[model samples]
Target: MIQNTVPGATRTQAQRTAATRAKLLDAAVDSLVEQGYSGISTQGIAKRAGVSRGAQLHHFPTKESLVVAAVEHLVDKRLMEILESQPDPEYGFEALFDAFTGPLFDAALELWVAARTDPALHAAMIQLERKVSDALRTGCLEIMGDRVSPDIIDLGIELARGFAVSALMRTPESDREFRERLLPVWKALVSK
Candidate 1:
């Protein structure tokens, strides 16, 4: 019974459901980023999304489920960006770098720390991490194509992740300087 706003076009039940789910997932990620995992509540997320609490509950019965789904949604989005990007090693590297350093990573980081203490979240994250890892690996391979070695791709991804983790402690300017210095070396290694 969801209504479509598109001019003269109606959305199917599935499309409406998907739209509602997407809104909840997006709001969930925003809450995670703005208010650490411990601070977020389902009611807050529903309010953020402008959806009813009942709707949010229907989509995600538990907080863990919502958080995990939000991470998965974010991962899927980043993977799509990686896949659609221009086929160049440098461009691909930058894309992966952005993905690792972006809001998606921020939300996931919150979940990762929270999961350490919450058994249910830990189990959910373990599975989501596997899926996310596989997807990103596949994205790296796609970006590098057959020109670069798998080892090189792995190194690049790991380096990007390292940079992401490093950002948590380092100043933004400092992190940028480090990345600027290291990117060329990484490019040279992969280009070989």
Candidate 2:
């Protein structure tokens, strides 16, 4: 006689492991975005992921490791999005600005502040920053395609990041106006 089976019973052990890891990673990132690094707790992450605390511990034994993994997960996703978009030069600045100015940036800012005081987090952040910088450079190169010098592209990205940071201090409408006003000037400068 045939036996009743679960719908996902055919999934291999590796697939199940991967699925659990993905859920944890996603939940961790959401926690980072919502609670910042200082506020996140392993139990909270596990509850958000709908996984047991043991499962969370089994996957990420330390809070630092989980936070690092979550940031890396987000960076990888953003890099993939930038690579896939293949934006034209006219829209490239907007795309780069978008990448630097969202929930990812908010979480990153929180980590950056906390990393300043935590040695282990500082080290992890250094490596992660290098990875992000390289990926962003690659994406910029692909998007600009010789239209702008590498130095110019670097400067533009920094400027965009600066604007993003400044956004926290200003009203949203003022920030929008500031970007709109300066973006044209930046484009003109780069075009020369």
Candidate 3:
């Protein structure tokens, strides 16, 4: 008999399963960010994750399920990052805006666009998006504390998201200027 040793040898079956699922979900997010919605596939995700096709299917039986799960997983990870970060006394709003427009938004934008014409994907994304929005709202409240009204935070989120979307249509130079000009206005609004 041959002896077999692996790094996860001590992990329970459930732990191993969860690890594999996480790997697949992460790979799915990478695919979504890099390839857009139409470019993602079960086979590609499995290959990227270094897992078998059957394993991917075992975890998520459909493409919609896989993409939705990936979105939820990525949002949860980003929320944790936001919640655990130390707020900057001088540039908290700027930092928050940057975090909102980061890679998570890019990946989620791809899914949002795809969902417009995909009933199943749209159905799955609606709930996940709401969950993400709620989590982000709570995180923002915690970060800002009593410094700003809830309405200001809500407007700030919409403004940041709109800027992020508009950036996709133009060059980076204009986007930089736009943010530079808008930041003070946003700060003033929050200080009111």
Decreasing TM-score order of the candidates: 2, 3, 1
lDDT of each: 0.86, 0.83, 0.82
Clashes of each: 0, 0, 0
User: Which 10 consecutive residues of model 1 have the lowest summed lDDT?
Assistant: 81-90
- State residue 86's C-alpha deviation in candidate 1, in Å: 2.0
All candidates: TM-score: 0.88, 0.90, 0.89
Candidate 3 wrong stretches, greater than 4 Å = 1-8
Winner by TM-score between candidate 3 and candidate 1: 3
Please report the TM-score between candidate 2 and the true structure: 0.90
User: After aligning candidate 2 to the native by TM-score, how far in Å is the CA of 133 from where it should be?
Assistant: 0.9
lDDT of 1 by residue, 9-100 (tens): 98888887898999999999999999999999999999999999999999999999999999999898878866875557557777768878
Cand. 1 Cα-lDDT:
0.86
> What 10-residue stretch in candidate 2 is worst by lDDT?
1-10
lDDT of 2 by residue, 3-92 (tens): 335785676667677888899888888898898889999899999999999989999997778878877888889989888867776787
Which residue runs does candidate 2 get wrong by more than 4 Å? 1-6
In the order shown, what is each candidate's alpha-carbon RMSD? 2.8, 3.7, 3.9
